[model samples]
Target: MTRVQANLLLLVIALIWGSAFVAQAQGMGVIGPMMFTGIRFLVGALVVAPLAWREWQQLNAQQRAPGRREAGKITALGVLMLMGAAMQQIGIVHTSVTNAGFLTALYVPLVPVLGIFFHRHWPHWSVWPGGLACLVGAFLLSGASSLQIGVGDAWVIASALPWAVHVLMVGRVADKMAAPFCVASGQFFVTGLMALLWALAFEPATLQAVQAAAWPILYTGVMSVGVAFTAQVVAQRYAHAADAAIILSSETVFAALFGYWMMGERLSPSGLAGCSLIFISMTLIQLIPVLKRRYS
Candidate 1:
């Protein structure tokens, strides 16, 4: 695929992911967040398992890297994913899809900062300014005074660190031992199981509730997790990494658009400004590395 084609594919994936936020929000009306997340991820795991099995068989045929399947890394990645997914799902129940989408993108700025602790290397000076922008933007989005913020926005913001950790964890293990599909399946299964435990402990989910949420659950699990994720993996093989990131970042824009169209959601002028700042931060984060490499 050409870079243009790959970017277009990435945009499609973004659209799917963005639309999935609506699915998530709608699902919350019928089922508890933990129950919805658990079933959604379990569906995703089922959808991806055959693909992982196929990838494993291909690796065996090609005698590629050891199919050792790093259990430890997968477990850690799953834990991070579970945290991120749970927070996002719960936040969506109280927050607008637009808020959830933009706030979730805060992880872009947080990723480089989080690397300091994990990789022991500080990020570029530009990253700090970007981080500041994210904070201001989030404040605007949350409609918060100096001291007060919305509970839903708080959950979305809290999810950012876990999302960053999940991204870093993936980087740390990307080339190590597991197949991509296998890792994805493992993450989904682990997250589903963990969320199930949480649901069992706190939220009550009946078969009727699950049945009521069936459509939204399937949409997120199948389209967002299985198809869109797989499409991203394939498209990135042919696209520039920076281009891929930028294209994928449009997921936030699409989320806002969908929220408005499907959910009649609207933000104040300050909130829109917040979204723009967060987007600017994400763009700078993606671009600064390439600019440095090009100039130096």
Candidate 2:
């Protein structure tokens, strides 16, 4: 894919992801966080299972034996992704959409931090300043005062760590598999199974709750998880890591806009300023390599 196409795909992913906040919030009104996630992922898995099966078939055809190592890597990557998605969903139930969106965006910067453990590569000097700015932005967007973190804010921040892990795992394993099929299948199956376990253990699986949240569940499961996730895997294949980070960061902007327009949740001036700063920080971090290459 060309850069333009990749960017556009990222934009689509952002839109779906951003709007998903609304779905999550609405779904929570009728069911517990884990229950909602369990059902949503079950639906997502059903949607993507065919894709994964096809990919598995293709792999079998291409190789005499697709080894256990490769299979294990795919399963590990899928599990990481499932954990991240579950955390994000549960966190969003407790946090404001603005907080959820911006805090999740932290994974964009956290990706480089995670690289240190595996590759022993420190981020460029510019990254520190940019990441700090983004951190401050997260503080403001979270609407925390007196340095006291709310339950929702804490949950979202915790979610960020696993999300960072998800991004790193995808970076490592995504290239080895068929991008669309691998992502669609892994996300669908892993998340689906986890959701089912949660539902069986804690949730009663009520038809009433499911009926009440039908639209949101369908939107999140099919559009957000199935379609948007597939696009993300495909687009990230073509884009640089920094560029992908920047693209994903746009989710915060779309989330804030959607909240204001759809839910009548207007942001204060400080909140808007914080959002702007976060965007600037992401843009700078993404561009730092280009700047260094030109000047050095």
Instruction: Give the number of the best model, judged by lDDT.
Output: 1
Per-residue C-alpha lDDT of model 2 across residues 1-296, encoded as one tens digit per residue: 87567767887888888889888889888877766776776787677778777777787788732456756776776677667766777776776765675577677778777777866767677767776676677657656553435787677777777767765566446665654666565656666677668777977667887899989989998988778877777776666554555557667667777989899988777778778887787677656776788899
Q: What is the alpha-carbon lDDT of model 1 when measured against the actual structure?
A: 0.74
Q: Candidate 2, clashing residue pairs?
A: none
Model 1 lDDT per residue over 1-296, tens place: 67567667877998998899799878988888888888888898899999888977887788873333576677777898889988877787787765775677677666666677677866667666766676677657655544424899799889978877765556346445546786778777888899989999999878998899999999998999788765665565565443444446556667776988999988778878877986787567556776898999
Cα distance off (Å), candidate 2, residue 282: 3.1
Residue-pair clashes per candidate, as listed? 0, 0
TM-score of 1: 0.76
